[model samples]
Target chain A: MRFGSIIKVALRALLRNTMRSILTALGIIIGVGAVIAMVSIGNGAKAQVEAQVASLGQNVITVFSGSMSSGGMRGGWGSAPTLTIEDAEAIEREVTGIVGVSPEVRDRNQVLANGLNWNTSVNGESPDYPDIRSWKIASGAMFSDQDVRSVAKVCVIGKTVADQLFANGDPVGQTLRIRNIPFKILGVLDSKGFNLFGQDQDDAVLVPYTSHMKRLSRRTNISSILIQAASADVIDKVQKDITEVLTQRRKGREPDFTVRNQVELAQTATATTQTMTLLLAAIASVSLLVGGIGIMNIMLVSVTERTREIGIRLAIGAHGSDVLMQFLIEATILSSLGGVIGILLGIGSSQLVSHLNGWPVLVSTASVVIAFVFSAAVGMFFGFYPARKAAQLDPIDALRYE
Target chain B: MPPVVKIEEIHKIYESGEVPVHAVRGVTLEIERGDFVALMGASGSGKSTLMNLLGCLDRPTRGRYLLDGIDVSQLDRNALADIRNQKLGFVFQGFNLLARTTALENVELPMLYGARKFTTKQIRERAMHCLDIVGLSQRFDHFPSQLSGGQQQRVAIARALVNEPQVLLADEPTGNLDTRTSAEVMGVFQKLNDEGITIVMVTHELDIAHFCKRNLILRDGVLVRDESVSNRSFAATELEKLSSAEAAAKLTGAKS
Candidate 1:
């Protein structure tokens, strides 16, 4: 018989048992839906992480102080003694690829402004800190180099601090109490949202390093050094240059600080997100496999149920291949329908999840297409054995079936 | 004259447990073109087995069978299927119509499967013509469940005739119908035979067998008798006489 006629016959037969057909398709629907939804969630999380990392300045590098031990007892919780303001200045002077550098000292303290009080951490750094870390002054102006040189009692507040303390009023050119000492608010930093560690980058305060050390904390040494390359591609060269410069400046003290590149940080975050996505997708694929088995089981039953019909067709004139094609087409149609429905359901579920939880959920077209194609392939692979059995039946015996 | 169907020393054995049951033992038969023949047998006489072999549905265990000078016994499964499509049409006692399909589509099925060059339009036209021959032209769109038992059998007959095969094989075609419906279906068979279509039917009813021109009786997997039914009685004429007598009795009762 013609292939078109066989397909039509198969479709008609399937339509005859509408409930059974829909039930069979449900397996595929769940399988494909789970795959798409899980992968989209994973992709969305990865994108959110990437966006946070990008906000920290993709071209910037951070070097944190290692632990210091004296008399076999760890020193007090302070900046590493080996690093200093001089080291930061020397790196700035000697490093060839470095565009800017900032020596940082951080401390958590309570601040009061306009009778509203909020506890927040403060970063003590050079005038180059804002540019190197990609922070922009949203209002007013940044503290100048003269402020660091003169130990000026001036600071910049982040948006979160401004929102809590100032409350819709401009805090620039105003004074806020830091550790019960008066400090003038020089500017407000733009919002930076949250980082991968879930810390709000926009909730802190910034001050000149000399003033913070001499006036507030009474400390002299620095904690970490922040540097920015000209672009993302120059980060490696910039790292090597800084390492060499710091080594020479510390009199070759075997590099007492840890320099972390943006590439490594990005890669670590990406690996973690990718592993999560893959694990989720693998678990969902188990359902797809189960769906395949479901199809096989149902097809076997269908072949047995239609044995008499098959026999009659064969007795009339249908070839074995014709019978095989008919059953296979039936299976393909069932799976394809299931796949389409599953895709729609998955997208809908993802959107619903995002809406309910207020979390980012991204759906990729490639993943949807892959899931659908895989479902169809699963149908063919699972439907083959039953179709073969149907095709190989003896016409006489089949006709005699009760 | 070339025979439409020829069987020579055909043997069919069925394996039952440890013993082999002989279904057909050295049965030989010849059926000429355009001859309406009947095979008469009681239950378990192996007449169905012989019909299965003649229809090319089963291979003979031994001996040669030829249909239109082609040795079907030696042919493979696919070749046998081709022969059935091109040369033979079958009608079963149960009126095996696809329950979901219309009468016209059912009749078009064989033509669709056979190696013919006819277009879909031509196939439908031929199917309608065959339904007309069986007096079911108006019921072409009706499903099998919508038709009576005799009408379904007539539809089966139309399906068998749509392919214009060399032989028509019917296994107890009127076995499921009442006396009146059976006579109506037999009338269709008589009319088709008069148009020079060869038919071979299996029947246990003597009255139904009398409708054919020849009869072959089987017992214990062998042909016991083969006779010409040139002067057998027909049930239709006998029923006509009975109905006329009833009508006359009704008139006499009214006069009294």
Candidate 2:
């Protein structure tokens, strides 16, 4: 029997009952659609998280100052200010692959400038703060090491701070008062989008750690330390060396800090979303199975309904394999058709979601192909039994079937 | 010029529940090329069973049956199907034209399943020619449902002849038609027979059997009678006389 002719016959049979064919394929359509939508949305969320992690800088490592369990007291991360300038300086000198280090001290303060007042975070850092954070200076310059050593009253302003304090003027060479203490503006930092924690990173002030420790919100210990490795290849070695140096600095005392790398952070951030995508895909796959079952059900009913037709074909000299091929091809075409429509539905719904909810969505070609091939496979898998049953039917019995 | 069909002591036994029922017992027959034969019997006489055996739809349990001298009685299912495709044509009582399919496509079905591949144009041309032979060329595109009963049976005949089989086996070809339509269908069969196409028909009606050149009677799984038909009915004359009778009745009814 000719393959093309068999397919043509199957198509003709399906067209005979167009409404039933469409209804039978609906299960596969919805199933593939759900899977595509969920995968796109989940991948979009993951990509956003990875981008945020990357924004923290390439080959970057940070030592967070809490996770301390000492003397019947448990302190969570960022709660205890155990890290200090001395520890940051020690790691900078001891670690060989490090290119830059910044002692970080964070506090919230209200500042007044040009008769306007706004409340924002105050960050204290070294001259290498911009490089370690991948933050660029929009104008003017960063505070120099001389400024740090001399405890000069100078600070750089984030874009939000610059916009707020000097709406009509350049922020450089302006004086902003923190706790009524006047500080000269050195430069304006470029805009950085919100971070993984949903904090507006651009809404803050930058100052020398020395000046912050001595003059404003004076505190003893620094909040954390940020370090930049020379390259991605040396990140793990640099991270290991920093952990050893910090652990040695404690001198057998309970370790009060956690060492983390941006790569690790990115993995941790995207893990949940990847798993969610798989979970949604798995749930969607269940619907595909249901869709396959639907195909099998309809095919079985069709086989019974067309028993006399099968009889006629067999009587007219069609081989059993020909009858089998006819029905199987019909099933595969129905499912593949559904798969295509589902992919379109998925892309459209994902796009609609992204447009309406502002959630990032990534629809890859690989997933579309997989969904299509999978639905086709499902159709064949479910189509085989009924097709075989039709093929094995006795022509005499089938001819007499009412 | 071997005989188209020759069966020697063909026997068919069916294992129905417990007691083995012998459907055809020691039946021997020969049908030559271009011959028209009618196998006739009452219900339960196994004539249908013998017809099935000749069509190769079922294999006989014991015998040497040669279809166009091919010795097909012991062949497997697939081989038998191939033989049926290449050498035999079948028409059923129900005018088994595939419903919803146009007459042309219906006729093209057998060619699609044949052992030799045919180009689409070739298949279409052959099917159209067969339909033309059946005098249904104008109705080639009409579906079976759209055609009248006689027309549908004619389409079935076209389908049967599309493959140009050695023998055409029709099981009650005009069973579903009225008397005039039966005569009309029989006339088509006669016309085809005159063109040297062999035909075998199964019928219980004596008048229907008289249309064939030979009559075969099976009684209780046995061939009790086989005789060359005398004064065999010619469908064309019978149809003409019926039409004249109808015209006369119409005149009388109008006068009344």
Candidate 3:
């Protein structure tokens, strides 16, 4: 018997029950849709995390001064300034993997410019601060080393600060006052959107460390130390070296600073994202399994309903294998059709979700193909026993079926 | 030439449930080419079981059956299916036409499984030819549900003949039809038999059996008699008489 004729017969049988066929395929459609949607959403979230991690300089590390206990009250890690400019210089000169270092002193202050005043944090650092944080100057020039040594009253402002003070106009070479002390704006830093903590990175003002200690806060000790590793591979080594040098400088006393590497932070974030993606995928795949079971149940019912039809074909000279192939093909067509429909629904709905919720969603082509092929395989796997049951029926008995 | 169908000492025992039932016992018969034979029996006489065995739908428990000089009693299921496709065709009491299919496609079904390597065009042409033979040429596109009882039997007959098998087996082909429609269906069978196609028909009605050339009477799973019809009835004449009688009855009803 020609296989083509068998396929035609099977298709005719399926078309006879169009509503039943579509309903039978609905299970597979939902199964594939869930998998695609969940995986895409997960992938988009991972990408978002990756972009956030990239915004924090890839090779940078931060060392915050340890907290202090006084009068039964303990301050947070950055509340007390145990780190000093000498420690920053020592780590830069002694650490083998250290590429650059900058001592930082931060104080929140209200600034006056353009006949308007805004509250923002003012940061004091050395000339190498831009290199240490991988920050770029968007306009004018950065404060040179001579400015830090001569205690010149000059400042480099972030994009947010520049926007707050000057609005549409360029703030470079303009003068602003902090605590009634006039300062020259040397440059505007490039925008860095938002950090992982949801704080705007371009919301600070930068000034020379000497000027901050002498005129702004009157502090001799530094608030924190920013360090950059020579390469991504040497971050851990640089962190350990900084910790050891600080401990020894304190004469074997408890460490006075907490050193954290950007590489480790990024790795931790990646691990959490991967675990979340896996969890969502696992939950979604359960629906696919239920769908496969639905196919099996419907196929079994179809076999029972068409017993007489099978008998007639058998009496007319159809082989057992032909009957088996017919039902198998019917099941496969149902699933593959469902798979195609599901893929379209999944992609469109994911895009809709992204637009509505403003959440990132990535629908990869590989995932679509895999979901489709997997549904087809599910059809075949679940379709087998029922098809075999149909093929094994006795023609004489089947013909007698009411 | 060897008989078209020769069954020797055939016995069929069915293990249905707790008890084994013997459906056919020691039945021997020979049907020659172009012979029109009717099998007559009451219910439980095993006539249908014997027909199933002859059609190769079931195997005999003890028998040596030869169809066209080939021993088919011991053949496996697949081989039996092939033999049935190549050598025999069947018509059922229900008129067993696939419900949603057009008459032409129903007729083409047997040829799809036959041994002949016919192209699609050849299959279609041959199906049309068989439908034409059964006088359903104009109703080729009609589904079984759209057709009358007599027309559906004719379509079934066309499907049985499309494979050009040596013997056509029919079990109670007119069981579901009225007397007039039964005569109409019998006319189709008589015409096919006249064209040299061998036929085996099973019917409980002696009036229907009178149209065949010979008759075999079965009782309690045994052949009690096998005899040639002394006075055979012509199906075309019977159909004419039935239609005119129906017309007269209708005319009288209209006058009343």
| Candidates 1 onward: DockQ, in order | 0.70, 0.77, 0.61
The order by descending lDDT is: 2, 3, 1
Q: What is the C-alpha lDDT profile of model 3 across A154-217, one tens digit per residue? A: 9999999898889979899889899999999999999988888789889998999889989999
TM-score of each prediction: 0.94, 0.93, 0.88
How do the residues B1-256 of candidate 1 rate in per-residue lDDT, one tens digit apiece? Answer: 7688889899999885589989899998999988889998988999999999988999999999989888889888788888898888889898989888999999999887867768888988999999999988999999999999999999999998888888999999999998777878888888888899899999999888888989999999999999999776565685575467657877323322
**For each candidate, what is the lDDT?**
0.88, 0.91, 0.89
With candidate 2 superimposed using the best TM-score fit, by how many Å does residue B12's alpha carbon deviate from the native? 2.7
Worst 10 residues of 3 chain B by lDDT: B247-256
lDDT of 1 by residue, A8-121 (tens): 898898899899888888899999999999999999989987877777875888877766787787854344566788878888888877777888888999999999899999
List where candidate 1 sits over 4 angstroms from the true fold.
A73-79, B232-256
TM-score of chain B of each: 0.92, 0.96, 0.95
Candidate 1 or 3, higher TM-score?
Answer: 1
Give the B-chain TM-score of model 1: 0.92
Q: Which ten residues in a row have the lowest lDDT in candidate 2 chain A?
A: A66-75
